[model samples]
Target chain A: MMPVGNLVGMVVRNTVRSPRHFALSAFGIVIGIASFVFFLGLSMGVRNVILGKIFPLEVVEVVAPRASFMGKDITKKLDDGTVEMIRARPEVKEATPRMKVAFPAAGFGMFEGQEIKFEVGGFCDGVDPKVLADDPKLAALFKDWEAAGADDPAKTVACVPPVVDDKGVAGKNPCPDPEFYYCDVQDNRCHRRVPVIVSPTLLELYNGQVASTHGLPVIGDLEQFVVERGGLARMRFTIALGETMVAGSAMATSDKKRRVEGMLIGITPKAMPIGMTVPIEYTRRWNQEFAGDEAASTYSSIVVTLNDKDRLAVFSAWLQEQDLRLEDQLGERFATAIFIVTTLFVLISFTIVTISSINIAHNFFMQVSERRREIGVLRAVGATRTDVKLIILGEAALIGVIGGLLGVGIAFAGAALVDWASATYLPRFPFKPPTYFDFKGWIIAGGLGFSTVFCVVGGYLPARKAAKLPPAQALAAQ
Target chain B: MSEAVIKLRDVKKSYGSGAARTPVLRGVSFEVARGELIALVGQSGSGKSTLLNIIGGLDTADAGDVEVLGHDIRKIGEKELAGLRNSSIGFVFQAFNLLDHLTCLGNVTLPASFTPGAKDVEARGLEALRRVGLVELAQRHPSELSGGQKQRVAIARALFGAPKLLLCDEPTGSLDSETGREVIEFFRELNEKDQMTLVIVTHERRVSSVARRIIAIRDGQLVDGEELALGAPGDAGGAGAGGPA
Candidate 1:
């Protein structure tokens, strides 16, 4: 057996001397590894957008089973009790009750200096403030204003209204705490606006579809627009409680109609898909005012956040026993589609690497044949058969390392080019990612490891043959 | 008499099997004393090289007792045989067998690579090159050197381990006569001054003339008198003495 240093020296010298012989072989490895890296990166990037942004898998929405015909209830009601029960499970990180506005409502708001009116029926829901706890900025702004004395007429103070000059331009309002309180012109009273959060999907829809069609300026970053920018960009809106566009849809009479101020806080995936989400306390108070105590307490749905997604099956089974079902069937289907597509791409890459390894084997066999006399000479100089084998394998390993690094680099460059093309040439669309490839560290390392193992495997048979060569016969060869 | 460095009794070897079997060394017996410089002279296909390979532990005898440097060649395992070949026997081949990719010094130190914990390999290689009077060409690759320089480098490599015996199989076969004469004189110097047991196998009378005694082989068997008078330089009378038995 040769010393490791001596073996490495010989292997390096031989490989460096005859690089052309291994170039073609290394090219095959590079192509195989590059394809593996590129395809895997693309898959991961698309999956991140789909599963992470559009339909997050971390939280599952649980809803009561639909009522049977003949006005009979079919399952247990989704309420605070159900939320508590769900939260008690070990897999449940959190279970927050969500309530839709039980009464008809209409919202009129000044967005970027333009007055806009929209119906809030079936679109608005309320969630616990704890949902935004992970984001301190959002959590700080989104809270129950009524619980903080906004609903008490005696607690309210006189507002310092904005001064209007002769040209009808209003100056900044003199309210001291403008972030949470606003000066209502009708009542001349400072009131805290109901803080609300909207889903990222809703923002994507508004920017990608609605804003473009309506010629309205799209909100770029919701947090920056609502929190960072001051004055009219603060997104103050008024909701006419108990009064909707459809006159007969109001559950309460005209005398019960009341207007409440609302403020846009930030965007979150946990928000309701199509509308603004406010604190559960606001919805409870309004539900009790316009409908009944039962409507106030009963939730529309419960969003269950799971600590371990691997135990989701068990959680889902428990939900079934509680007469509820997960509302993420579409997300599950999308995840399955992504998995199958990624697996197919990986299998295709594996096949390419396997074929390339065979090519490596063929090249090594030819090299061994050409260097028979050299092997014989080494054997004559006291090199064991194992030494000959190791020298050959070591050369193959060097080729693998070089080819693997080049392959990874090429894949990264290819991804950057694709991302540049997407950003430069492609039109904006809903959920379109900024980049289409995610080159994670493990993926690059795996590509290199895969190349080296395959190359070594390819060299095994040829190395064995070289090691088994008869020294006498090899020396006597012409 | 000096102790026998190499002892072989009734050594037999053959190639192939069945009707295709051809015996290369049949019942050949010989002893080479320590520090003795001898030659085995034979024509092509006369098995002189085969006998030398067995003596150097590069090949095994079909049925016989063979010993080199006090170790039984037939009884040792492949690893032990490789160790014996690496440390106890030095082989100088006709083709020089210098790796073209390596420098002259690199080729000289090739055998030392197999010795675990062996230090100062380059220095020892340089010393061996100095002995061969090619120290200045240590950095030159084998392809850059002339045929005679390459042969001297191969000899330096053969002497790297300071082995107990040196085996030469037509060592001067590839050189001009003058270069061949120089290599032969170097072999004589190694034997006389260094007391290295040397065995030179050759068909050329000039190469054999430098040896103290000659053993001629014919048709896989030694001649009646294994030891012959040392042939004088340029002697051509017994050039074809062992042809076809």
Candidate 2:
């Protein structure tokens, strides 16, 4: 057999002489390889989008029910004690009672003449700024938010009321803290006035309803609004204190159009008991509301903070032992669904790529058949059958390479287009699928290489037949 | 007398089998010694080409002991047979069989390329073309050459590897009388100077007279072998001289 290099050189010389035919065969391989590359990148991009939105790696969200009550509404109250239980777990690095709220809660916010019916679905659950500092992930998110200036000074903690006590010392909550978002009648201190945080989305919607004469609101300043209490209307507005909301506006219940409003107050970590289940007020309220056995009492879920994040499952099992659910945001399910669908799409794209590669192989086989006379001459002149085969295969591989490169080029263009569109229209997560021309380009190149080489393999039998033709008969052939 | 370079003993060859079988050679025997030139004279269907093919190892005889350059033709596989043809036997076809795509030198060097250890093959091919006095035309394609020149290139290709036997199916069949004479002269010179063994299959009496011996075949059977002295010294030729090797 001639050296593989010599065979390759001959193939190159011959195929290069007939550029048009080689280009066509190579184009087929390019399509197959590109499909492979772009599809995989697309799959990864979609996966990133789903996971980025759903299972953001750094977030540690804690959850519990919103309210507590006596009588028939006793079941509605959250068992704040679960928070303390989670905090006591060894994995608990830092814990906070993220207070949530619902509409129909009494508040004294009103307008002139008619009491403003303010349905305040408190979007921003109250959180201490210290929690953001303590959790590196939250700190990073805040830094990004601050860099973007997504909110004003008022929206940031810079201007909010300092968390303090009744004696005028900072770091206190005047009203009793609900274990979750609500309080029982017996946890009487909650009856005192307290503030609620609102999300920017809620603010945007609320701004649409309010007239411009009121001026676009800033985060820290108090905004006047009205509410209804026990069928009677009242005119009131708390000190407009702005706070940032992390996620959605709120979950809508019935279309009852209930009105509730309140001030948003900040609290320090010291204001709540250390490792106490259901901040003191939440426990007191739960006791008053359910009046049930302590062990049987519980909330919907608890957010356990682990000292070592790797132990979340261990703590989760512990929570499960106490008969509680672990609640994740709605995004988790959405991400899972997206991942499944995207994977299927990738598989489908790969199938198309495989079929296209086969087509390329067929085309190369035809190419080899067309060149039988030339091949015969080469073989006659001492070119071994193996040499001819290599030459043919080498041509196939070259075509694959060209085709693969073309596909990767296409993917790069597509990636640029997508990124441009995302930057223009949907800049929420700043997500653009990874560009194909980078690390992922090798994948495409490999695909091209494999397919082209595979195409050569496809034409192997034909090349052999061409090579084995008796030179005498070959010369005599038409 | 020189040792026979090619020998066939009662070679019987037929194509197909059973009802479809047709014999191309019927009990033919011949021996070609070194430095001899012989003509196989016959009509188109008289098996001259088949006889040439068998000698060249391009075809097999059903029953025969055929040898070329000390290798049993029947015992070798197709690949080995091809190797035998490459290294030991050279063919000059009626059509000139010069590859149209190659230059004259390329055509000449083609057979050498298949030869093992054919180093400096380009130089060797050039030298062969020079020997044929067509070295100046080396770069030109076969189409650019006249019929005589094309035949000369074919002859140069045959001479490239210095084969033990040169088989010419019809060296002058496609040429004019003058060109045919020139080709015959070239063959006569090659045989006398190089001591080359030559086998010419032809229907032309003019082509046959140039050979020291002639074998006639009619309808796939050997008809006669005769010596045509033509004033050559110490010559006793034909199938009588081509007795058992």
Candidate 3:
């Protein structure tokens, strides 16, 4: 066998001598690798938007099962005790209890001096502040402001109450800082505006569908809107307690409705899919005041975060035993569909690569036939059969490296083009990603490795054929 | 005689299968002493080239006790045979088989690549080119050189390993008579000054004329001159004889 350096030198020299042949032989590999990279990147990007935004996989929502008509009595209320029990389980990282505002409510907000009113009857939930811990800014702003003022009276700011007329209408006596304080009409007292969070999915839906349809300006950047633009102060709204637009007078607890202010703090995946989420203390207070103490203490559902998502099956089984069920079956179905599509794309890429390798084999066989005399000359000068084989395989590996790099570059260019086209021409849709492809480091490395391995595999038989050629016969070959 | 560098006894080789088989070398035997220059003269199909290939460890004999530099050619594995060929024997062919892509120096240094830890390979290659009087043309590719220059480059490559024996198969077959004569003279000079052992397999009279002894073959069997040269008791049959000088 020859020294590795010399062998490599010879292989490079031989390979470079015929660039046209190398390019033709490597074309199949380039196409195969490009397709492979493009498909994998696209799948990853789509999966990110689907799983990360539309239906997150980190936490599973567990709710009490409905009672059966046969009176099986399997329905267990989700409460503080149940939350503690779930949190104590080894598989559960956290169990955050969420309660729906049992009383009727409606919100009217002013944004840029334009009034927007919406019913909050089925669109409001309350959760613990710890649910927003992943985002420091959100966590800081989403605390129970009522509890904070109660804990320290110094945190409270005094405000004048709005004067009410005999017709059940009130004159505005807005608090100096509506973000943190509200003039409550019922108690004639100042209270903090309930810090609320909305889901990122809601923002996406509004931007992609609602805002476009209504010719409203979309919330372009979440960070800028929530942090840099005075956060909650920019989106202050009044929530009328014990009243709702859906059932006007019938659902009201009294003829005179109590009004408190609410503010949008931040958006997060932990928030309700189509609702405003406030700190649990505020909901508990409101539920107790308008409904009953039982409504305040019992939770509507619990969000269970797992330490390892792989242990979801065990956790789900435990939930089933507790007469609870996971509420995100749509997420599972989406995941399965995405997985099947990704696998099919991968299989098609693999088939292209496999066929390309056969092309490489055919090209190498022709090269060997053409270079019979060259092989004989090398053998005559002291190269062994193994040396010849190494030289040929080395050339194949070089071609693979070149082809792999080119393929990946082309895939990136293709992705950029697709993203550009989507941004420039395609209509906006919910959960549409900024780019349609994600070229992770592993995918690039795997693409290069896959190309090189297949090329070497293709060259093996031809290399063996070259090695087996008798030096004398090879020399005599024309 | 000086210790034999190559010894062959009852060597036999054939081509093709049973019914179609044609014998190429039949019970042929000879010894080449160290530092001796000899020629094996035969017609195209008489198997002189095949005999040379067997001696060089490039081809296996069907039956034989063949030894070169004291290593049994038949008993050793392919790797050992390759090592023997790489270090102890050199081959020169009629086509001046230089890799066309490489320069003269590159072609000459090709053999050193297979010899591990071969120090000063480039310097040694230059020296080999110097010995062949082609040092000035070291950077020239084979396609740019004359037929005689290419053959000299081939010779330089063959001498790169400083092999004990040089085997030439029609080394001047592609050259003009004048250039062929010059190459033959260079071989004679190498034999005389460097004490290099050489086996020339050729049908040309000029190549045979320069050798110290000539062994003629007919119908795949050695004729008279080899028996006389080896001092074996045998009848002097029809042969092309050229005894020591």
Candidate 4:
């Protein structure tokens, strides 16, 4: 066999003998690899948006089992007693009970006078407003959700890291009042924002699927178009309480309705199929006057938050053992779809690459046949069979690496083109991705590396055939 | 005292299998002492090339024991045989099978690439090219060289590492008469001046006349001086002078 120092030169020299054939052989592999990288980048970008922007991993919803009763399915109330029992576990960092507010559709808007009706009658859920202050872990987890950089202007798209005081504690309660955004303390008169948690997915759904159909304005970049607007579009809310309302009545009079002006202070992800959530204390206070029988401080379900996901299994098992079920609210079906799509994309890419490999092998076989005399001469000049094999396989590997790098470059340029076209001409495209592709270093390397290996693997048999050609017969022929 | 560079005893070789099996070398026995210039003369398909290949360690003998440069043929591995070929035997072919892409220097240094940790390959290759009087054509690719120049490069390649035995398979078959004569004279001079042992396989009288001993092969068997009527046609004065080198 040839020495290590000369192997690369020999391979390159042989490959350069017929550049057109080398290019033709590598073209198929390049296409396969480029599409592979493009699809990988798309999937990774989608994952960032779905998981990073929408799902809150630190929170999980727990509900009591309906099997406790024999009648039609009823939500077994999660009273204060149940909340304490579940919170007793060491893994439970914070447990906040939730309640549903019963308000007229006209009452759900920003401020008292400006009536902005929701197409689906926006959800007004309730929870303890002091949950963030009581649980430092939950506050720290959602520090960025409720507050922005203190120095940032109210208009720009900027989100800074959570500031830490000198004592090393993260600054979470940026607002002067923990339970309110804007208020007046004198005369026991205080007007506060209805602190609500609405998912970014809801805004996306409204803009993409629901809003334009219903003749509503499409919301793009909620922080810019909505939150920074500081008007009916964002920082306001209104609630009304009927003084003489009856339960489940067809015509209940609301002549003594109490309208309250509110502001939007905090935003949380409703990761599940739930809607807007507010403080439960506010809901119970309103429900007490509206319906005496429905004013009890019991909840059908509660959300328990943990500091880390490693402790979730133990906590979840403990809950299930106690007839409580858990829901990640991050979507099981969404995760499965991502997994299936990713797998199919990879399999298809490999199938194309494998076909290309076969093409490479068959192409080199032709070259080997053409160079039989050359092989014989090399054998006569002290090159062993192994050396010939190494030379051929080395050429194939070089072609593979070249094709892989070309594929990655093609993918990047292709992604840039897509992003530009979408932004320029298809701005109204329902699911306008923030970016066309996400380029990860390791993934690119892996794609290139795998392609190179497969090329070598594909070259194995043909290289062996080249090596095993009998030198004397080959020399005799020419 | 002169030592035997190549020794073969009862060496046999055949091609194909069963009904198509054709014998090439049948019980061949011979020895060429170190520094002896010999010509293996035979017609086409006379198995002369096969015998030379076996001696060069490029092919294996099927039936008998053979030794080249003190390495037993049947005892060692293929890599060891390759190493033996790399170090002790150099082959020069008729077609001048220099890779078209490599320069003359690159072609000459080809053998050094196979030996592990070979140093000064360029210097040695230039020296060999200089010996062949083609030192000025060292940087020229084979395609850029003339027929005589190509043959000289091939010869320089064979002589690059200075092996113990140089084997030429009709080295001048593709060259014109003048170039062929030049290559033959080059071989004679190397044999006489450098003490380089040589085995030239040819049917040309010009090639065989310069050899010290002309061995004839017919249908896989070595014939005597009287039975060389068909193979050695122009061996009038050169044939019967068979004695010690």
Candidate 5:
């Protein structure tokens, strides 16, 4: 064989001479390759975001009182009595009863005609400490809480984190109504005051405002959180009560702040677990006299943290066996939907790439036919069928590479746009957005490889035609 | 010591099938000696082109012996035939058939690119172009050249490989009478100076004069082959009985 360099030069010259045709043929292939890459990236990214990073790792099973869109008809409420029943079960490692106060939801403590809206504080019984040690993700946060106060470590006290809003905790806890504090006060309301662990999306909502107001440095201050449902709402004596508790915090980080209301709610890692509390006796005493909502007195939900995350399904199934209903709500369902969408995106992209490859093949076929005489002349002189095939296939591979790069660029831009959009909308809706960029490499590289193969396949028809052209007739075509 | 470059005995060819299977070449017998310049001339539908194609290894004969350079074309497969065509012979067509994409130099270098150990094909290509007085136009593409220039490029391409025989199929049909005459003179020079075997299939009176031997075909059979004198001979132009079947 002659030097590959010479052959390459000839191919380049031939392709360049008819630049219009060459460009047209490769255009479809390039676009196809790009689409494949983009789709793959997005799918992989979605998978990573949804599954790779989520909080409240230990508190796997949550018993909520509220009926979701796909409501499960539960026969009874999981109050203090139900928590005791769950504790008696063999599969249940540690069952803690938590409650959500409705009187606070109706209205918070008002001072000097300035009424403060009370956040639905999640209250839980003190954890056995062994449960925290069993789960790694929970152990870190438990250690952080323990470090906050080692002396009388509020082991069974209710801890509320301050709402780190856009203006950073807005005010100091020096006054009685700290929630309505002004922006100028440099206080510990954001960090030490409340131990607020928000969603990554919601974090932007506060925009480090809580950090500055809390008089604490923002670095290493943030925490991971998860929220699980508070068990059933029950009406007792003319009061419709819904009491949910945020678990996983021993005591509020600061001494001045008794309780703080986080703006966002629902079952997420950012929301506290259903187990951590100031002790059930203290919760009954706080709600019975301080607030008139009678139903808030009982344990509305029993939060069960198992020995292993994999055992969650077994525990949940056991709960069902005991006639206790387990329902996954709209938010968790929405995460599952993300996976489906990513799968569809991949399929659609592959289809587009396939079509583009076909288009490239058609273009090459026509080109070979048009250049039959040239092919024959080459053959007559000394070009082998292999040489002709190489030129065609080489062109296709080039198209795939160029297209793949372009597609990756497009995918990056798309991911950025999605991130921007989520940042803008997540806090307002009070739901955390999953992280991005997890599956990028697989999508981009795999897409490129797939697209290149498609392009090469497209080149097959034209290559065969070029090889099959009779030197006699092809030469005689002139 | 007079080895035959091409040998054919009772070679036959047909097209289609059943009643439609029209036999093109029937029982043709011939031999082309090494370094022999012989012109095979015939009218339209004389099957001269078919015979030429068989000899060039571009088409296969149905029956009988057909050999070129010690390889039997009838028995050998398409691959060997193609190899034979590429290494042993060169062709010049009526239309000049130059690739539009390649320059005159690129065109001439194409054939030798196929042959093994033909590494310095480009230099030989340039030499061939120089011989045709188109060395300066080597970079110019075929479309950039005139009809006469294109044909000259084709001639250069044929000579670049240094094949045993240069096959011409009405090589001057597309050019004017003057350019055609000039092309014939170049063939004469090639035959006389380099002893290049030049087979020109033509109907032109002046074209045949360049060749020492002229063979005429009527239908598929060879009817006449005679030595031509330097000056005008008796009925040399239409002396053969070969015409349209």
Candidate 6:
């Protein structure tokens, strides 16, 4: 019986003694493992961003009852009454209504002598601020999130009216704090800018459609565009107070158009595609003045933020009972496509790794043939059959470790390169993930473990062949 | 009354199968008492090496019992045979099978490393080199050593584990006349000074002359014991045994 320590020493010494042999055996594994890690990083990045960041983990979207190609005529509008009713449900923590409107108005102007202008016309949304402000947990979602604020001084707190007595502070409601964009909702008086929660979809649409058509340099993820490119710079725009209008287009009366400076506050999740979310009260005021007897009392959609993810199915079931439909942005077509591509990527990765293992086995067999005399010498000295087998397997394990580490390095470098390219050249890509790769520790470990196990298994048969040789015959081989 | 240190009975060995099968050993038999200096003399393919392999536990006999250091080769498992080989027998080949990658000391220590619970391998290796007068060349690799020095290193490795039996196959077959003579003298010294039990296979007359007993093999069978006899100069100072005490 060979001492285990001596066997280990011999294994290491013999393996390290032949540098060329070691490297050749490990190279195949390195290529295989690197491809596995690289492709996996890509698939995982797309899955997380599409399923996690964009769609979010919990919150579900409920669109109003409307005519659809499916021909399901459920006449329950997602109005304020629906929002209240949904909010009253046990599974629903808070329900926020989202109203869609065309870009109120967009034009370029000089603010502090900096030229700024809206380059595209996107949709907008009117939202009541109470959703985030009242629910601490929901507000917590936007706590650290921020958009590139317009540097216009008028949009700041300078126009904030002082706190008034209970009788009312001059106006029924002044801008609630510095975060509020406007005040004096009773008469639509001018005060600061309008606080708005802009959805990330607006940036995606502009970058994808408007920027490409105009041949402009594309913007990266929302944060980079907002912070580095000053995306919200042109917050001051005048929209027609009438029902239908465009910035440069005409309205029934020019006087009907009102001027308001809008300030971007936070970002809305992509699952809720409502454009820019503004104060619903201000939007109601405009609607009352223009729509005569029919102001939009029902909302375009309601977003139900769940208290617990476990209750999402319950809330979804209840929404169905109320004749509402939960809209999934990731439709069946997109889901099936992702599933097929992801499956293909995984199959390709496993095949490469398995083939590499077989290659490792072939290499070991050749090594055994070349080292037959050496194995005989070891046996002649005193090595048992098990010792010879251990030495061979130990060498294979070392190869696996070296290949695994190299694979991780290659994966990281490739990911970083892809991320840099995405930030610089491919920013308009539909999946606007904050970073193109997420190098989770467990994923890297799995890659390492898989390669090692395959290598050991691959080397087994050759090791046994070497070990079974009779010492006298083996000694005569050379 | 006691058994011999090494024994073989009707050991038969063949290579290949059926029509192509070539018999290498045919019912050959021998015994070596403790401390015997023996020479197994035969031409190449005369089965002397095959008999030595069976005695050393490196090869199994197809039909026979081979006992070395009280362990029956036919009855034991590979692990037990390996242990017997490790603890009781050491081999010196004509090629001086010293691993080129290892220093003289490393090659000498190799056998001890295979023995479980072996400790102070360097100390024991140095001691063996000291006995063989190659302590100064302990750090030199086989490639850098002279033929005589490499044989000395091989001898040192065989003696390192304090093996009970030293088996050499044409140990001087590759050396020149002068080097070969020196290796033979070294073997004589080990046998006489340490009372070491030795079984050497060789065709060289000079090598067999130093042995107390010479067994001639021909065509896988032992030559008649009476002609050459088990003991040469049987009256020469207890022959193989040291003076009484």
TM-scores for chain B, in order? 0.92, 0.91, 0.92, 0.91, 0.87, 0.92
TM-score of 5: 0.66
TM-score of model number 4: 0.81
When 2 and 3 are scored with TM-score, the better candidate is 3
RMSD of 6: 7.4
| Ordered list by TM-score, greatest first | 3, 1, 4, 6, 5, 2
Please identify model 2 stretches exceeding 4 Å from their true place.
A23-27, A52-380, A383-398, A410-442, A467-472, B111-118, B225-241
Candidate 3 Cα misplacement greater than 4 A, ranges: A70-74, A148-159, A164-178, A222-231, A248-257, B224-245
lDDT of 4 by residue, A1-478 (tens): 6777789988888778788988988998898899889888887777665555555445778877665357765666678888998788787788888766553423455322344544212255676655657445334322222233422132232223236589654444333442343222222233334445555566667677777776666665544654446533255554555521234643246454555434444344532244665556666665665545454465647888887755767887888787778864553445457769988998899998999999998888888888888888778777888998999899999999989999999989999998888788884643457586788987799779977987888788889998888777667655
What would the TM-score be for candidate 2 when compared with the true structure?
0.63
Q: Recovered native contacts in candidate 1, as a fraction?
A: 0.69
Which scores greater on DockQ, model 3 or model 4? Answer: 3
Residues A190-240 of candidate 5 have per-residue lDDT tens digits of: 221212223343343333554355453322223222111121100000111
Interface RMSD of 5: 2.7
lDDT of 3 by residue, B12-125 (tens): 999999899999999888888888888888889898999999999878899979999999999988778778878888889999989988999999998887888889989999
Model 5 stretches with alpha carbons more than 4 Å out? A1-7, A53-335, A396-439, B75-81, B112-118, B224-245
Window of ten residues with lowest summed lDDT in model 4 chain A: A150-159
Query: How many angstroms is residue B114 displaced in model 3 relative to the true structure, after the best TM-score fit?
Result: 1.3
Q: Per-residue error at A61 for model 5, in Å?
A: 5.5
Model 4 scores what on Cα lDDT? 0.73
Residue pairs with colliding backbones in model 3 are none
* Model 5 chain A lowest lDDT segment of ten: A231-240
Instruction: Please give the TM-score for the first chain of candidate 4.
Output: 0.71
Highest-TM-score candidate: 3
